[model samples]
Target: MDPVRNPYSPGAGRQPAALVGRDAPRSSWRVALERIERGRSSQPFVLYGLRGVGKTVLLSNFRRAAAERGWITAQVEAGAGKSLRESLGETLHAPLADLARPSAGRRLLIALRTALSFKASYDANGIWNFGLEAASAPGGGADTGVLETDLRKLVHDLAAAAEEEGVGLAILIDEAQDLAEEELVAICAIAHAAAQDEWRVLFAFAGLPSLPRVLAEAKSYAERFLYERIEELHGDAASEALTDPAASENVRWEPSAVKLIVEESAGYPYFLQQFGQDTWNAALEAAITYDDARVGAAAGRATLDNGFFRARWDRATPSEKNYLRAMADDGDAGSSSGTIAARLGRKPASFGPLRANLIAKGLVYAPEHGIVAFTVPGMAGFIARQPSTD
Candidate 1:
């Protein structure tokens, strides 16, 4: 098979050739977009799942749906130590700038000019410009001196601009779990105010399982969020993910080969693409063979280990590596902290700060009392295969 014709995409956050088993949510979101256009309220969505369950991809798909409805949209990935105020300010610039604000032209111009001015104070390398002072912070700028208060004003202004332009604004945020509790509440405030004023704003965020609790704490209204929990694809959908793309390229996959690939992947979308790409490159016959799947599985192990797992591994200190190894030794999908502590030859109580740090890093999460699980799917197996040098 020619590699050029390989339709599967295996990169991080890359959209697959065929998005499978997500039709329900996609259709629901399309309806929500339409409702916003008609000045009707819709429950906003927050997508939650473990790593590799396609939250980012689904967010991307939803953004495209909003675009089709002629709505203004912005998608951003939240990162550690990054200010949501700064990110939203920067991302909202273009859409708000492009908005037809003729009625309120003077007021919006003053606000946006002040907002973009703040971005210039920081350089490409993140070096701050010391000894630089601005004449004034725009009264309506999102980057107000305070995060919460200013964010509300900023959001209100953008929604006003969008409503004036006869369009709705959609903000899709990825890695919402990275946001601090205070930041989440600030966003909830923005949403609450938007609804109260009947402004045209739609928000969707994708994050790990921990997102709901923080969001709920932010506002009681968050309880009504359209929570979509992404999980492994159904068996039929998983099979279609494997077979349909190949068939479109005029290549067929044997039943035996498809069965082998699906079984090995455990219906994970990213792993499916990993297997599909490697298997296609390994195949020689017109039809994919079971042997090709075996080879692909072998190839995928190294690809996942070196590319995916190693990135996290490289970031771990010696103690963190040993801590992870201990968890891997005691684990299936998850294990009790006490068990991991025993494996590390320490008392569980003493590991409290370390456990908290891991949670903050998005490496592991507490599913319930006393137990922790990897944020990423298949992470335990990858950790088990690592050399135990630490």
Candidate 2:
């Protein structure tokens, strides 16, 4: 065990040393992959949940497993500070290159040539070939439209080749909501094309709470075509993530502590991982046995004060902030859209967009019609600290 490690990482995008709370989901996720491999569930899948919910890490692990299973995998994160079309093109091309057979190098070059036109530039080899051009504007004779077409064609071809050669293709997109509506549609269209061609190209995406709705809005057939949900681990499953892995590492978690952590996390993998890490860190720090009190103390107030939590805080406009303050003072975690609007001194109708925005940011979760509450546990404590009268 690394004594200095602070396992409770709460950053915008942090990767784990080893995924501690993911063992349970693997079985069901494997079923999904097997279905994709057998060409049973070919539609894109959207995995979504509140921020810091470990959806991203699950997707990464699933992608690695898919690759190891002989599936060609392409990973694209939608919010990595790039245009969706550009990122999608690059993502599609990488897997085509990766899974290309040695004999298919010519086909890959031809596809690239057909997609991009380069200037005549000579390298040290003195092989006067066309220099690679911009993907969007391949200099010579290639059209931007052709790049799009060639990309789709290339993926379909790759999938077909993989199938013939006894492999599969998997495309995993995280933070998928950041993708432009048009690009999402285009990628789905490509997936549809692959399906028509009997090519096994599967997509798995993870994003904020609104992701499924976004996809549904983009394509009416999205709901019918995809398996979408926040990845969940049940009691036994959650126990496996904590106890089984620890046992392998020669570390042990008291059953009571594991049960408490599972209950607190609500089976959310990221929370489970965070709590386990914090408990471990806490135990190490105090040089004491890993007891509930010590672990809980180590987690302290910052357990949920994560990047996701801060993001919700940062999303509040001055008026929204005032509304939140009012709610906090009233001992309310959230308000009805109309009530929030009224408190903010705005017309109720104008609150629709703001409410949607808030929901998408994962600060609030809708429990029933017209009712919302903080998604993060114990957020009301932080809200109480804010000056409500401001």
Candidate 3:
């Protein structure tokens, strides 16, 4: 017997290529990359949104498109304390090495080593060696301050080399928000240098809402450019996401199920995937058409309960869970911290732990000062539907 397909892609980031509901954004990105390849400055793009908004997948698509355009592409996921220069340099090296060519390879090698000299371990012989140690060292003998210069030269030389070989150069950076402070400044410097020299360095970045802030904090010039935000779907796009793919696969989604998803997801991509997964399971368990009644019936069934919702549900702390339910009950007239304190029957500051915990879980955010709300639109509704223990 074949196993049932898991439609709920809670792990959206793990499958970048099979992303759904992002065609418009992908097309826009392709256009941006095309401009960069033609020696025009592509807008430095930042795909910002809350967690599970498909920002990561969209950025990966941009990277893939850059490669197809004969551009040398490299990708690195940024994190605190990680050397963005070394990561960028490592990814850029393969194509750069390929481009290094007869005598240029030797010169580039010397230059790379010199640029990276601060890290004494990155010797000439050690550059090409594959191991954890080489990858960790500062890239090439270039001073970190002149990372902009070294990277600009790397791209220019690589483009020249690629042009000779009938190719071009592109760079993809993910999680741009997590970059170390100095590394981020260096990256902006490189972007400015690329623009000044008209070098063929193309970058596509995706991260949490803070990413644009980080870029601007690094260099205000980033503000002069336009960055596209990949928002949740609505209206026709949501309908298409629900119906088009299912219809093509010869599977029919009950109109009610689709509507339920739209209402529950509030058009958020992650919730869309979650609702879709749930509806599919609902259809399977009943051996009946997946209509509103069947889905409603399935809601109480343990099979569906133990599915996507429970997975996310189980991950939340008791206090965070309590906080969510409190929000749901408070309705549109949001609860005051004092009101919440009274209802929860605890010290005013006692809710502090739960509030901060919920925010950290990414389940809620402060839309205004002292006013926190669920990060997902349908979250309140779902919480409302659950049994209230307190």
Candidate 4:
């Protein structure tokens, strides 16, 4: 096998050669885009799932599709900053500034300025005019610095500006579960106002399974936004993810070999790519075999250990590491806090801070009240292999 001809790319946020098992979300999203473009009220979107479930890939694909349709689009990550205002202002400035409709562009700019003013962390000059001869002043209504009150007006006015420019504005935000309560409310407010005014704008977010809870806490009308679960690929889709790319380049996967990798990967997109890449590298001929898959699976697991799981493992404090090891010993899915605490020789209540800290680090999450689980797929196996600290 030629490593140079390897078509499989397994990395963070890397798009699979063939995106599989996403017809439902993609079709629904196509309709949502059209609905927003036509000024028809449609639910905002939240694609919630586990980490590495391809939420970012799906969001990026949607943003790319919107851009292809000439929609004004901005993609930003949540939790990288204190507030979303600065990142959004920076994101929207480029697209809106180049719109060629000065009046409409100014409205967007004014909204941006209003948002930017609240982000004192953003230097005044950091928000550039993009060489456009501009005279837009910040509007009083949007510059109030009250997130709930002002964000609605800002996004509403931006949608109006988009309408004027004969385009629509859509933002794709990732890691939405990390958004502050006020930030989430401000976002919900924008959507609420958009629905009332029929604004030609959309906001789509991608986050972990707990995103619904976060959104529900932010606004009572959170159900107005449709949530899609991006689970792992399935039988046919999973097979295609492994076979199609290989077939494209004159490499053939043996049927049993394909089944082996797909079943081992549990239809997860990342694992599919990882196994495919490793299997391709391990095979001696054009045909990938079950024997090759077995070797490749071992190689891929080692790779994930040093890269995927190791990164998270390194981030844990010694006590946190022990906590994860205990949880890992319990099972693959989730463990009760009581069980993990018992493993660590402590009462459940005494481990509250540690559990919360692990969740905060994104290494673990509470699937239910008092139940903890690893955020990454196959993490429990990686943790279980570690020598116990206790």
Residue lDDT tens for model 1, 69-163: 77778888887456786677567656655552444444355445444444443323442221223234243344445667776665665565566
Per-residue CA lDDT of model 4 for 1-390, tens digit only, reads: 999999898987898888878888888888888888877877689998887889999999889888888888889999996468767766766775566344445665555454445333344455544343433565435546676665666676667666766767788899999987778988887887787778988889999888887888789898878999888898899999999999988999999999999888898888889989999999999989999999998898888888988899999999999888888876668899998888878899999898889988999887778888888888988887877752
Q: Which number leads on lDDT?
A: 4
Task: Indicate which candidate wins on TM-score.
Answer: 4
Question: Per-residue lDDT for 134-234 in model 2, tens only?
Answer: 23322233223433454575565556555664667777888887777767777667766665565667778887666777777777777765554555477
Question: How many residue pairs clash (N, CA or C atoms closer than 3 angstroms) in each of the candidate models, in the order given?
Answer: 0, 0, 10, 0
Best to worst by lDDT, what's the order?
4, 1, 2, 3
Worst 10-residue lDDT window for candidate 2 reads: 118-127
TM-score, model 4 to reference: 0.92
> How close to the true structure is residue 155 of candidate 3, measured as C-alpha lDDT?
57
- TM-scores for every predicted model: 0.88, 0.74, 0.69, 0.92
Better of 1 and 3 by lDDT: 1
> In model 4, how large is the Cα lDDT of residue 254?
92
- Write one digit per residue (lDDT tens) for candidate 3, span 1-390: 011543345455654213566777788777766665566766566787766667777777777787776666777888734577667666665654544444443334443444344233323354353212333323353544555555555555555444444444666677776777776786777777666666655666776665676688789887855577777787867756656645644566666667766775667666566556556555644221447424633543333346434555666877777766767777633456666677778877877877876655556655545676554444555566667662
Candidate 1's TM-score:
0.88
- Superposed Cα deviation of residue 248, candidate 2 (Å): 3.3
